[model samples]
Target chain A: MEALLEVRELSLRFGGITALSQIGLAVAEGETLAVIGPNGSGKTSLFNCITSIYRPTSGAISFRGEPLTRHSPDEVTRLGIARTFQNLRLFHNMSVLDNLMVGRHLHFRKNLLAAVLRLRGEETRHRRRCEEIVEFLNLEPVRKTRAGDCPYGVQKRVELGRALATEPRLLLLDEPVSGLTQEEKEEFAYWIHEIRGRFGITILLVEHDLRVASRLAGRMVALDHGVKIAEGTPAAVQRHPDVIKAYLGE
Target chain B: MDLVESYAEDLRFARRPAARVLLGLLLAALAVFPWVAAEHLVFLATLIALYSIGVIGQNLLIGYTGQISFGQAGFLAIGAFAFGHLRIWGAPFALALLGAGALAAVAGVFVGFPSLRLKGPYLSIATLGFGVAVYQVFVNWEVLSGGRSGLAIASLQPMFGLSGTRWTYYVYVLLLTGFTLAAYNIVSSFIGRAFVAIRDSDIAAEVNGVSLTRYKLLAFAISSFYTGVHGALYAQILGHIEPQIFNVLESITLFVAVIIGGVASIEGSILGAVFVTLVPKVFANFREMVPVVYGVTILLVLIFEPLGLFGRWLKTRLYFQLWPFR
Candidate 1:
């Protein structure tokens, strides 16, 4: 498999505290990689750094063989990288469909003048793209429902829909099923697989749920105290003493 | 199927009677304001309308887009002085106004460029400093602004070379109508949606490919453009251009009106402007106790209804409209 993302000696620090230290990782194209860790194990820190929310103190991140540094989150997104937040961050005031439409903003071809004037081709194309996304996400029925008013499971689904709407080649999900119920978690696992199968996009998921990782991830890495202690197939990582110690109690 | 449904939804919004009636009343009011009011009051109304235009820009930035700007007065200054000076140099007042808007928009981009690196209160401070610095420049530049004393504005020319208070009355009303209509168009458009999205969750907006910098700067630019037009209108109406009119207090008053009226609301902008404008005049009899009355009213409003008077009025209107269901 071709490498879609490469992180080399990625180090991030906040004042005197080192959040991530010399951690290197690579994601292959069309692969689902999961990062599992205890709370405060730097899983979220790494995600934030990769997404440019937290600029790394020192490191090199390359996407599709090109360097990714000194770029804002918005700039990184335009390069085809999209992510979902740990907590659902859907626009609360916007309807589910409008939330999804925001993801397609990069794909909007018309300028402000065209949008303001309701130009012929621009309006039609803009409307069509919005409709296509709503259908693709199975969000037609709840399209007009405000995102904040949705159930936890549905909100997660809407976040997924939003990420997918960006048409990114790489999708990063941070605990996509964190607060979901048992049934909802199962449904989310199924959709994770479905997304990979349907889109052939690379996915990097940060999840604490072992069952979720086992169900969908092709490979897994375990981190503890800001260090990657073990990495391999899910079964191998589960068997690793350090990984088990970090999770089950030392 | 989704596209078809969306089109149906769009049609529903277009046909909504509440939106239509509200808009109709706004237009009717703006059209009739000058005809009923005295000459001095008409001038005050023009000032309010002009200030509302700037408030419309602030609403887009502070209210809808969730970008904090203290430099709105800076943009107003750019517009006012540019128009004032250009008109003094024998340029057509209309063209000067257009030029002022263009210049302010370019300056808005200059200021907004540094904003991508900042957020929240930091951005607000940066913008505030920018406004103050611009005001200082206008004041110190004696040749352009006549320094602290200010410069005189030429009277507005009417259709077919008419002049005087009556002619200016129609012009102010027409300009106010045009500004309000433009603001209305923006409030209901895709651009408006983008700003609201950015306001609510900028990270989510970006992950979905809403470029934060592009939209932020666009908000600033478009907002400055409106403010510039307002400044031009102001200069013409007052027949005077001074840095004092675009000071920090004026900026805060405009912002206060929007907040007191309601953020992200066109009606709120107008209401706030009108209430702020006329309330002082109405309280002239109370003289010494005016501040007490004003302060008490503001505190009560802020405590009981945080969304401002217009927000409360909107809730009441909506309640009546959906009476049984609500």
Candidate 2:
């Protein structure tokens, strides 16, 4: 399959300190790839660089062979890349449903005039689409709940639900299983697999737990101190001496 | 993937027939207000309605979009002057009112664009400058605003059968109701969702494909149009105006009205307008206590009810909903 996303020699630096060094990653169409690393492994930084939240000091990111530069964050999302923040950046003040509606914002083609005049023809259609996503995630119990008021695991799901509402082709999940209980993690992993099975979406996940990462991801790339140390099957990368050293710092 | 549920069906509130009846009756009473009430009281009601219209705009920007504007009165000034001039030139009231609002919307774009990247205190300062500049324009532009003396607008009575004072109540009420509903529609719609999302988190908003620059400018445009229309009507009701009428304090008062009424509630707009308007009358006997009362009221709201009148109203609703229990 053709690579959906390609990163060439990606390097990010903050003043004198480096966050990522000569990193390269390729995600093929409808494939699940995992980036596993210890703290300061540059996983989150890699996602930021792709999203252009922080422009890489050196490197190139291409989506379907198209360079992703000069596009704002919203533009990037509109280009079919949606991501979740590691810190669960849901709209805390808004309800879970409204948070999903915010995800549908890009789908709206009506201008301000059509909106102010109370044109429901387009709006109701979009709301129905959003409701489908809500049910898909089994978030009906907390549909009306404020994001800030929900439990951490539920908030994470809501964040995922929100990212899903945007109809993304590539979902950059930043630690989807973090803070989740064992059962919750299993259930979430199930959903993640189903997301690929059902929607054919390419997922580039950043994860901390090895078992969960290996379970969900078909392949793994391990980073340590901002450098790529191992790449292969999850089990193979897990046993790589350099990766072990990076995780243990031994 | 088999799920077919839609919030549009589930989220629809059961039709409230009685609420509509009550609103109709209340509007009927307001329509007849000028004839039944004392003429002076009718005039006060008209002013209050106009202020309510302006307050709705102010609150939408500050409360819903999380954008701050310290100089909303600038839009009002633009509306007032534009409307006044359009009316004097034989333009009809409806067209002139819309034209005035459009003029202000353009100014909103001008102010809103450069400040797209600006947020919080910096945005506030930019708005403050805008307000100051508008006031200065009114003061210095001799031909446009007739300078400090301001120009006399055509009386509402001769135009559209709205007798400057009494008959104009119906017009004010009509505009107030229409704009309030429009504001409600905007808030309930996805557009309002976009505004609130930006208010909640600009970064998240963009990530979800909400263009911050577009929505930020939109909030300013919609907000200023309302305030501008109110300003136009204010000139008509007052029958005369000067640059001093819409000073910096006037802008601050409008901002405060939104806060005390309810930051994000539609009903809060009217409640805030009425409370803010009546403050001067309730304390008309002792003018010195006016600011004290205003300051104390805001302080009290911040302390107890951070969401202002709307927050208190929600709490009351929940209490009633959970009545007969602790």
Candidate 3:
């Protein structure tokens, strides 16, 4: 399988504290790869580097064989990479549906003249696309409610819906089920599973829950202290000696 | 209940039929107001219309874009001075107005640079310094602004067989209506959503593909253009442009209008403008007490209705819409 996203020798440091060092990973097209690690294992740091929020001290990230280092966060999204945060970052003041619409920002016709003229054809078409995402995520009940007011589970789904709205080729989910209830987790896992098959999307997720991670991802990469400890099938990675010591200690 | 069956219906200016009727009646009243009212009242109405444009501009930066600016007076001064210069150089009224707005927009972009590094009170102070600097320039730059004595603007040329105050009133009101529609269109479009997204979470917005630098500067330019146009009209109305007129107090007043009207609301900008304009007239007998009255009114509104006058109006409408339920 061709790599949809390729990371090589990526290193991130805050002064002397290294967040990620010599971290290398590749996500193949249409595959769901989970990065499982303990707290502060440089999972989010890797995502930030890929999105260009933080400049990696060393190494390179490329999507479809094109270099992604030094591109701005919005530029990354323009290149068909979308991500959700560990903590939900919904536009609290805006409506739930509007949150999804914002994900479609890059896709919208951005002519200021057209905007000032209040042209509706293109806007209506894009809005219909967002509506489809809303239906898929089962967010129709709170579609008009403020994103800040939605329950945690709903907000998570809204974030997912928002990422999906971007129509990204590579979706990065950071702790998508961290605070979700058991039922919500199951629902989220199902959605994550369906997303790959339904949209032919490639996913790279960071999960702390091994059960959820092992269930949703066919392939797994384990990280510890900013280094990749193991990478293989979920069953093999979970049983690796390095991953066991990183999570359970000596 | 009114149902929006189509996406087009959902995006309509007045979603409900009742709102459309109310909007029609309000517009009709506005069209006839100058003819039916006294001369002084017409002048006040015109002032409100012009000031509303400035207030709307302030709201766009502070409310929608979540950027604070206390230098709107500086932009206004740029506009007023630019218009004065353009008119003196034989530019037509529309051309002069647009030139004034463009000049102010250029200044707005300059001010926006500091915002990339500063936020909240720090940004406000930087803008306040800008307002002071502009005032000082007008005071010292004799050739440009005629110095401390002030610059005299010529009266408006007759158009459509209408001249003097009535013509000015009609022109200002028409421009106000056009600008309000434009503002509405902007706030509902993708650009507006990008602005709101940045305000809510710039990180999320960037991840979702909104460039902060581009949108922030655009907000400043657009907002400044609105105020700059207002300042051009104001120069005509006052017939004299002075450094003292575009002071820190005026900047504060514009900021107050955004808050007292409601942040991120079009109707709130107009409401705030009306309140700010009418207070002095309402206290005409006690001219010295006008500022005191403004202070009291703002305090009361902030405490009782944090969302501002427009929020209160929304609540009232909702009450009636769901009558007997609560």
Candidate 4:
């Protein structure tokens, strides 16, 4: 399969602290790639570099063979990348349905005049797509609920739904199932695998929970102290000595 | 599709057909009001209508997009001066207002560019300086005022030779109606959702593919354009203009009305504007205490109802829905 995203020797630093150092990874089209690391192990830093939230201190990231060096976050998103935050960065004051509509903002074409005329055709098309995502996520019950007020699990679901609404080819999920129940984790793992096939998306996820990460990602990259310590099948990575030392507090 | 789920969805928005009909009747009453009311009352209502449009525009910026501005009066001044010049040159009224709106929108974008990096008190101070700078320019520039003495606005010609306050009165009322609907459509549509999204979390908004620069400037431009429209109407109704019309205090009055009515609610802003305008007249006897009274009213509203009158209205609506049992 063609490489959809390639991070070559990515290094991100904040003054003296190294967030990610000489990190490298590749996600193929329609593959699940998980970055598993302990707290402060630079898992999120990797995601941020790819999304262009933080320009890497050194090295390069390319999407579809084009250098993503100069792109801003929103520009990166428009290039068909979507992501969800680990702590759930949702529009707190807006209704649940409105959040989904926000995700479809890129696809809206009307401006001041057409909107003032109550033009329904353009708006209705986007609304129909948003409603489909709502229904799929089983969020119909809290469709009107303010995202801030939704239960944590539901917020995570909405965040995912929101990213999905962007119609992205690459989905970056940062700890998508951390706070989810056991059943939810299993359900979410199913969706993770299913989404790769269903949407033909390349997913790069960061999760600390080994069981969930190993279950969801076919291959895993383990990091320790800003360095990629191990990479291979999830089973093999889990048994690596450095991976054990990183998670076991050695 | 089940009971609880559907009910919650329905309650999320636009829950009242009967109440909407009642609102339509109230608007019809407003339509015919100019004919029956005394001439003085028509003038007062027209002032209220103009300010209603101004405050509605103000509400969209601070209330919806969560950007604070103390400089809308600058846009109003720019529009009024531009309209005053156009009117003096014998340009038609509608075209002149459009020109005024476009000019003010240009200024809005110009000023709103650096303002994108500002928020909270920093944004407020930047806009406050803008208002002051515009005010000084109007006062000092002989060209802007047609001289320090100010310019005279042309009287609006009667339509179809229909002579009366009723003709112009209907025009103002109809424009206000159009403006109110436009505001409604904006808040309920994709454009408004983008505003709210940027307001709530700009980082998340960018990640979700909203261009902050585009929406922020659009908000400023749209907000200023409407304020300019209000300024044009103000010039026509008053028939004279000076820099004094767009002072910092004038900006405050509109801003206060928006807060007192309800921060983000359209009806709240309009109601607040009318209430603030008329209440001062009732206490015209104690004219010295008007500002004092105004300050106290706003403080009281903030203390008792931070959401302004709209919060109480929404609560009352819920209360009535669950009446008798609750």
Lowest lDDT 10-residue stretch of candidate 2 chain B: B7-16
Each candidate's TM vs. the true structure?
Answer: 0.90, 0.95, 0.97, 0.94
lDDT of each residue in B47-149, candidate 1, tens digit only: 6767677777777778888888888888888888888888888989778989889888999988988778888999989999998999888888887677767
Residues A59-119 of candidate 2: C-alpha lDDT, one tens digit per residue: 8999988988668889999889999988988899888988988898899885766666766
Ranking by lDDT: 3, 2, 4, 1
- CAPRI-wise, candidate 3 is high
Query: Measured by TM-score, how close is model 2 to the native structure?
Result: 0.95
Chain A TM per prediction: 0.95, 0.98, 0.98, 0.96
lDDT value, residue B308 of candidate 2: 88
Q: Give the higher-DockQ candidate: 1 or 4.
A: 1
> What tens-digit string does per-residue lDDT give for candidate 4 at A1-250?
7789999998999999999899888889888988998899998888888888889999999999989979888899999999999988999988898899899988888577877776656666777888888877889999889999999988998999999999999999999989889988887887778778777888998997888888888899999889999999999999999988888866
Count of backbone collisions within predicted model 3: 0
Share of native interface contacts present in candidate 3: 0.89
DockQ of each: 0.56, 0.73, 0.86, 0.55
Per-residue lDDT for B1-326 in model 2, tens only?
22426544443332355556867799789877887888789878988999999999999999899889998878989999899899889898889999999999889988998567788999999999999999988888888788756788877754566566766877788889899888987887878998998888888888899888888998999999998998998887777777778788888888888889999887898889998899999889998888788889999998988888888888998898689896
Candidate 3: tens digits of C-alpha lDDT, residues A1-250: 7899999999999999999999999999989999999999999999999999999999999999999997999999999999999988999999998999999899987899989989877789989999999889999899999999999999999999999999999999999999989999999999999999999999999998889999989899999999999999999998999999998999
> DockQ rank, highest first?
3, 2, 1, 4
lDDT (Cα atoms) of all candidates against the true structure = 0.80, 0.87, 0.92, 0.87
Better of 2 and 4 by TM-score: 2
Give the least accurate 10-residue stretch of model 1 chain B, judged by summed lDDT: B1-10
Sum up the clashes in candidate 4: 0
